[model samples]
Target: MMRLWSIKRVLLAALMLALVQSAGAAKPAAAETLTIGLIPELNVFKQMERFRPLGAYLSRETGVEIRFTILSRYGNLVESFQRDGMDGAFFGSFTGALAIEQLGVVPLARPVNLDGESTYHGVIYARKDSGIRDFADMRDKKFAFVEKATTAGYVYPLAYLRENGVESLDNHFAEYFFAGSHDATIYAVLDGKADLGASKNSVFDWVRAADPRVDAEIEVLALSGNVPSNGLCVRPDLDPGIRERLKQVLLRLHESAEGRKVLERFNALRFIETSVADYAPVYAWAERAGIDLKHYDYENR
Candidate 1:
């Protein structure tokens, strides 16, 4: 009888402890992990290599475990942020605006380029032999854009065309194709498959360096006025203290020696503060282009 009682008592104790542990596990965590989502224009390995330094710097500075995440497409990044998997993101102006308007995110800062310019031009180019001289010449030519989500590719180019009285792809281009990324768009233009293409001037410069012949064959038919490039943003409900710290670290990145070195690695001049108000023109452009910026769905066409 005594032995049975002892075993029963031990079993009851174990069961009670397990119930208490389960209750404790149900509580929220003390510290939340910071998750960052990046674009996947380049190869996955190359993308990770480019942002690894920033990840390390963030970890060292904030004592937080910073993770570098990349989605197959910029659209996926925006979708994931909406689903609450991503805490912060670096996005093009269009996607950033969508994230803000769609997912309750907010623009935090933007990196100035090596020229100390926070903006870059959107260029529309055509093959040298295509006889496309300017925006008017793009009528009825087969065209390609970098990505639907890229401002340089879709937003700015479409806005420029609309402002110039070229309203829709069906009205202007013989057909339109999305090349999935700026690099791919350049390649399409260089191969003569696309009579016209739109992308950031910086991307064109990178392509020129890689292939001298592309520079010879490709000619810019039109260029949009300068606009801000990629922006770093955060979720709407991110803690104020953490948000302020991130902003401070980014804004001062070019001021300190270590931070400057990191910026050099990223080919950035410096970081500057910005707000949703800064992207007002982008929103207006979207409105003019008939894009419902708030209801952007990544999965569907």
Candidate 2:
């Protein structure tokens, strides 16, 4: 009888081991990871740090890992996007319009800033004592630009200059160079480095609020029409379920306590859904600047 009991115990142990192995084999894998790029807009470090919390929050809420890659320059976004194997990006207004046209990326959502403003405009500014009062005064003056792939930094200045009877930057300005960022562009003019410069008003306001010299030493030359703020856009071929999941997560962020914390960090009131029509003004600006979005090349030159 004791011998039979030992045999029964051995059988039970073997059976339990098999059951555990079977359960392990049936367990599901962890969620997929998605890497997204942040367009070059503000100070790169600040921008990256600002979005880290949001990324973590989104990852937790969606059950998928979300990673942010900070772009250091406003280069050919689409080319760099794909080459770096990014799943999508938080595209700037101009880059968003380009991605929609070129890559068919779907616009997901955009933020309404703390001021309850969902849009921003370009400001052409000059140092108070630089004597650049109007378009004609820009002649022979050094200019600072954020980049060509930017609406506020390039399109507005181009359109504004052309409308004022200046056809090109080639011979009109004494010197011009891409300042790489709006913040840098503003400082370039403020520090007497550039006679004229352009930046999105939102950034200008943010910078001005921090520096006394911005209000004391800078004067506005022109303001572009309102353009949609930076927005989240996803790859056209992304998983439909994941895409919809992200959109819903952002669109409904205002209703949750955790989500509110994320919004507060961004200095945003809430996020709103986006549509193709939102980019019309951007295309119009590009057209006025004589740029065809479908074939325009700002990547190299």
Candidate 3:
């Protein structure tokens, strides 16, 4: 009886040890990092610096590690999303629409401006002394556009030019180039590198505020019809719970002091929930402009 009892005690101890080992092996590991991509609307350094606080806020809110990435070109942002390289993105209206149609990205939220408006216009501008008074005067002048994928910077201006009988940029302009960013486009024109340039109105306004001389030096030649605001989007396949939480955090950003600071730094009044249909105007513009949705290549430019 004593021998049998000793064997039973040893077996019980071994069983408990096995259960402990199993629990240790099953313990959860740290959360995986999520990467969010941004279009090159501004200088890369400024983009990262301005967005880092927002990324950190998201990380803390979702209990998931977050990293921000800025693509060198707008098309690269779309390519990255197609490749599943980005978990989420802050996409311009044109690129956002393309991503939605191509990759099924989910529109999450968009920023509201201080005027309580969620829409912005595209503008063509030139040096005040350039003598280019209107869109018709832009013909045969050196031109600079931000990027082909940019709605305010490229598409709107291109459509306006086409409609006004300035059909071919390559044929009409003495020289032209993609300045790669809104600031670059403005500086190109101000420095006399280009006679005319195009960019989003809000961005131009921000630049004017930063350097009052820009207002004195530059004049708006024409403005495009209203365009949808940029939007935050996520991969359709992103974890549903995480996606919902991220949307909630952005929508509620104005409700917190720290969040408000972040929003202010981004030059936004607040973030509001957005839907896929909000970008329909962009699609319509593209269709009317005869822009090839699937075959357009940003690399060859």
Candidate 4:
């Protein structure tokens, strides 16, 4: 009886040791969360809804929590990146370049339109009844611009105007206002609050789709030269594993039905890899227009 009891004790101790080892092996690594910053492309509420699905999808695929942050001003977005407040971001072409230049953010991917193209145009628009027929007609009239940092909204349009002999808004337009968003700029023109407004072609299309009457209410006065579409970017110092996973998921977002839905919400057909070279024209245009990109005050109302 004593021998049998000794054997049982040995077996019980071995089993406990094995269980302890198993628990240690099965323990999960610490959870990580990645915060992504976004500039206001739509109204605050709609912009949140637009990116929520993508953030969830990224979190699920990367096994890390993903958070979406929206900034009211473009300068704030750049500042966030500089301060390590964002792990990644979606930025407009000019702003993306700025982030790259200022923060060393790595350009990752950009969305392709439904037509399978990645380039988009900026548009100067006026109400159909406003008698603003073209860029020249904008002279001596009040103008609306989305934001100074926006490539399509401010840079490209200003470049076009300057190229055509309008030296400065102060000298040409009666006055100008920064509407702070594409939708606001459009609304300003449609409501006769401004004689002309500038925004990206995609934003104009989205507004028209949401409110069909916009097509008849507003007319395109001029189109800026083609510019690279918005792109995803990551901090240069991001974890290699997380960065790889993010790149894979974004590049493949359109392959799965669930991912496709998210893309559609952003008016994107698919996401494709892009490089810094793709945005060279944006820099060129800014220089040509004499816009001081490095020191430009985006927060100035």
Candidate 5:
């Protein structure tokens, strides 16, 4: 009777081992996925559509499904980042610097534009018919600005204005408000909603190409010095192999026809490696704007 009981136990153990082996055979490895956040540098829908192909491509190449989340505004990045539990984000210059300092994320890659330009500039612009060509002419005119956390949109433009002898935005302009995005800020001035506005040169060019009214009505007033373009950064604690694979995939995108298609949609020629050191220009502009990164530090609610 004891031998019979031992035989039954042995059979049960063997059956369990067979089931585990079959499961392993069915799936050699569990599929993995990553969720990367996208800053609203462009219209949210456009940003997602533009990046979907890249995400699909990366997923196919790396065996990791890639997902993206579009952040509505730039101001809440720090707290929102932790809240969303994203794997990483494609950060704009100012926010990228903040993330590096605060979240300890590592810079991975940035896109070089099809125009052979990797850096972008802050552009202050207005309607050509507005008769405001220079800084002094901007006095008492309604102003449109992108989020305060932006470099080309707010920081550099404010610094440029203050450096040019403007004491106060409220005192100088009829009124000013954050447009929530670079393209929206540009449109505010072009559509006569605001007299003057600031945006990144890249988005301005994009807007110009899509609308002839842009050139016929609007004119660029001032441009900030070159600042590093938006770059992808990831949590420092991310798996090293996945991190390296992502970087390599981005760097090599230009090598294939399908990859070229993705780059063309992005108006970029290729992706280049980046580092935390690339954010130095942001600090310079922030100082000129009299803004401190610490002041912008966000907390979890």
Candidate 6:
């Protein structure tokens, strides 16, 4: 009887152990997908082509699928990050500030361009012969800006205009159109569709090389003070381990020949570590301009 009782108890204990092990295993692990959201700041297809290789490299390095999602506008990208749909993103300064304040997304790194600087300028541009000699000359002239969400494309230019006593587009220009991106704004000016345009100075420099018509058509009238460049960021809920790993990988990209080639496609010289604190200037600018640096609740939309 004792021997039979021992066998029964041992079997029962074994079953209990199995049940405990299964319960522990059933708990979900950290997220498997790392979704990267980007603004369609250029031709959508070209943006995808520029980033696909980097995404693949990241996936191969981390053993996690890196998915790239392009939102129609920067605002929508901010909304998605707030809702936790995106694990990370590459965002302009304005949108990145919104994500940091509203979604708790943290800035991880920024790309350094060939100039060895991580800051870009906001430039006011016009045709050399348009008689718009300076920003003040923009009065009664047609203008183009990227979407309102863009920093150099809209915010900085607007702020600069307002500070110089130009309050509204109506008060300062004969007409204004949103070209939707730095490239498009430049294009609009080159095509003679607008008398003045605003764009990222670095973008202007790079694009001018590809299409010298930009130089032949438009001249920079003014430039905003240096502004921090765009950056890679991650949602607040991201696993710290994964985030750290990503940061390490990014920082070393320019160290390898293959990595440098990938970054070169974006006109990036290298990746440098960054943090939410580094973008405080951008937040200050938005705040002074009375722009809400928070993502609108879009559950219904």
Best by lDDT: 2
Descending-TM-score candidate ranking? 2, 3, 5, 4, 6, 1
> Candidate 4: which stretches are off by over 4 Å?
1-29
- lDDT by residue for model 1 (192-231), tens: 8899889888777767888997778988877766667787
Tens digits of lDDT, candidate 2, 157-187: 9999988888779799999989889999999
The true-versus-predicted C-alpha distance at residue 237 of model 5, in Å, is 0.2
User: What TM-score would you give candidate 5 relative to the actual structure?
Assistant: 0.88
lDDT of 4 at 48: 93
User: How do the residues 116-149 of candidate 5 rate in per-residue lDDT, one tens digit apiece?
Assistant: 9889999999888888989879988888988877
Which of candidates 3 and 6 reaches a greater lDDT?
3
TM-score, one value per model: 0.83, 0.89, 0.89, 0.87, 0.88, 0.85
Clashes of each: 0, 0, 0, 0, 0, 0
Q: What C-alpha lDDT do the candidate models reach, one value each?
A: 0.80, 0.89, 0.86, 0.85, 0.87, 0.82
Between candidates 4 and 5, the TM-score winner: 5
Clashing residue pairs in candidate 1 are none
Worst 10 contiguous positions by lDDT, candidate 5: 292-301
Cα deviation of 90, candidate 2, in Å: 0.6
> Which ranking of candidates, highest lDDT first?
2, 5, 3, 4, 6, 1
Give one digit per residue, the lDDT tens place, for model 4 in 1-301.
9999999999999999999999988998668998888888888998899888888888998898998889987667887776766888899888887887878889888889876779888988888787788765777888899988888889888888888988768989898998888888888887889988899988888888888768878888788777788888999999988888888999999899999898987778888898989888888888877876677666655
